[model samples]
Target: MAHPVRSDAEVLSVASEGVYHRLVLSARDAAPRVRPGHFATLAVGGPQSAMLLRRAFSIHRADVEAGTVELVVAERGEGTRELARARPGDRLDLIAPLGTPFPLPDGPVSALLVAADYGSAPLLALGEEIKRRGGQVGFILGAATADRLYGVEQARALTQDVLVVTEDGSAGLQGLVTDPLAQAVKAIDATVVHACGPMPMLREVSAIALGLGVRCHTAVEAAMACGVGICMTCVLPVVGEDGVSRFVRSCTDGPVFDGARVRWDDIGTVPPDLEGAAAMGGQG
Candidate 1:
């Protein structure tokens, strides 16, 4: 049954990956109309060493009737490691339904969804939503090798057109995912593009989109300490309304942004010294 609205609760569940983990909670109460390509902040820690910050994760799926939300997380760092150790029946705390969602194209459209690595999570729901809205959706997935390539089967199940590319040519095309993307863009008349992956890949895709005169949207990943706007940690440079370049917090305003409006070159070209500083203690 759909869980009714309540403050975000922590839930523990066993996943197919053989890990028992904690997941941030969100339901219809917080986002009655939550759409695809949106994310939330989850607070995860134990009582003694409770961390004060939240981790941002895109919603993998939202079941309004069931009042549940899901996310696909990889065990990467200390926080994620802790989450991986959670047992069934354990509870977790979360702040959810945060940040702006990807914009739906206004007219009847052919759309392409490009995802690299774990970035594919959000696109699943986005593709489902687009299909529900009567729009055609195609997907392109890229990975380093066969082992690293996850979600191909799931993405294939969700959309009829699925293209897979790997650096090692382990499974699909012999080249990078962008190769297939470039080909697909040329072969079809896609009206809009939605992509989430490594910055370098997105930059190239954005350039292609610009040349084609098609609208594109991208989701960016940055080092973020606080998932809310208060921390000012996940800042990216963007051009404001007046044409003056300024910084915007990715945790709040985005994680998703219009491809044409982003200062991609600046983001791709951070100075070595500044990059070092940010890696140490500076805000991105």
Candidate 2:
């Protein structure tokens, strides 16, 4: 893992994408080290605001030559709303290239990339990387509506096989992304699956991939109060190689993890079977 850096990044552009905002920052030192699934945390509310915690976002694109990093921001709260209003000349405190990145295949392999809404940000980069490595890539992008679905055109540009699904019948298919996932995986003969989405979708994707005997990697959408792993706000129960379940910090250990190892159904509540749960008096 490359050492993360604290940089004062200048806003390069802020473009509106339907209900979301795309923020491009001039981050020279941090741009080159970013890989697919790596994230960044920005100080919101400026210097004097009461909001102390930073807002974390997945690195959408990193342009080493341009010295820029892009992030997709959804204005769900005041912090993000403030970030959306940033002008091209404004500067923001940024700590980036953090967390484990998606592990790429050593050789060309058929891979399926799955994402939902803005989660499409990271997987797009992953698909590009896979193509550059001489691998075949397919995308399954889902959202609640047509406006929420992202990267459909981009995914088509990357590869010929791109699937889009929307919940409200406003887009390609009117159903959950997982509805046709198994058939799609088999159709493409995918050897590995990479996903970044809501917890429920990820859980279903993991199960389908594992059930089909294919490797699956997922980037969890955990809320990190401190992106550098200090606050323990994003720890979740994950089974280790030794078969012991432990509460691991997502900020450092992973924003990306082996899909099979994550206790997806047991998320949010600390399972009593966790390594140190007995000492902490975790209830069943």
Task: Give the alpha-carbon lDDT of every model.
Answer: 0.72, 0.93
> Which tens-of-lDDT digit does each residue in 14-119 have in candidate 1?
4643222324343546556556777766666855666766667777777787667777666877777776666666666655666667787564568899988777
- Prediction 2 TM-score vs. true: 0.98
Worst window of 10 by summed lDDT in candidate 1: 1-10
TM-scores for every candidate against the unseen true structure:
0.85, 0.98
Candidate 2: misplaced stretches above 4 Å?
282-284
The reply for model 1, stretches above 4 Å from the true place, is 1-8, 17-28, 31-33, 268-284
What is model 2's C-alpha RMSD? 1.4
| Candidate that would win on lDDT | 2
lDDT of 2: 0.93
Task: Compute the lDDT for candidate 1.
Answer: 0.72
